[model samples]
Target: MTLSFDGTVIVPAADPDDGERTAEALVPHLTPTSSVIIVNVIEKAGGAPDKASMEQREKHAEDIFERTRRPLQSTDAALETDILYGTDIVERIFAEAQDRTADAVVFAPREGNRLAELLTGDVARRLVKEASVPVVALPQRDV
Candidate 1:
């Protein structure tokens, strides 16, 4: 089945590198009518002190958006950036998708080992398995 990127897509990116790579992978799939919402979720500590200050985290999110926008600039797709806050990253992403009425949640899975994924609760796996909307893991190009 051919996947169409005609409507709004929610893209959750963890970092600058992931954002850039995901954008690159998604570029080929998007059409002139596609709307891309590239998001960075600032994980809260759930009442505890955050790992980084809000200002710093916001700056980092901006960096992610900047890099992500590079490859996407070549496409005619509408691009937007967002910063979200939540204790659970996957939940925040899903909430955004629902709020935006996104057609799909698209991303390029970040590289990690089994142990790391297990320790971190494997967000990529959860995103795919527990999605209310379609989740597309675009294949990453070799560096």
Candidate 2:
């Protein structure tokens, strides 16, 4: 089957490299007219949080977006960035996807220890199970 994405694509930007890697991997599938929305969610901790830490998190997220956008410069794909704060990461992503009227959701499979997966819950697995739009996970690879 020939696969392609044209409308807004919701990309999970969990790390600096995740977005870059995902864009590169999708180069073959995406057309020059495609637009990608790179999103990073900072899971909020319960209870009141300090202002300084929150500011720091936002700054760091901007840095990640800058780094991620660098590699995608070679592609004709239009890029957009979003930094979100929420308790449920997956839900936040889904909400953004729906609000943006995304044609698909793309993510780079994050490798974690079994214990980590059990503790935090696997995002990739959960997305596959519940995503309303098509979910595309690029094959795992070393950075």
| Number of the top lDDT candidate | 1
Error of 1 at 89 (Å): 0.8
> Residue-wise lDDT of candidate 2 within 1-143, one digit each (tens)?
87777767988877777666776676666678889888888888757663448777788788778877876677788988999878888888999999898998897777678899888788878898888888988764444
Which runs of model 1 end up more than 4 angstroms from their true locations? none
* Worst 10 contiguous positions by lDDT, candidate 1: 134-143
lDDT (tens digit, per residue) of candidate 1 on 89-138: 99999999999999999999988999999998999999999998999999
RMSD of 1: 1.2
Total colliding residue pairs, candidate 1:
0
Whole-model lDDT per candidate: 0.93, 0.80
Query: Number of the top candidate by TM-score?
Result: 1
Relative to the true structure, candidate 2 reaches a TM of 0.86
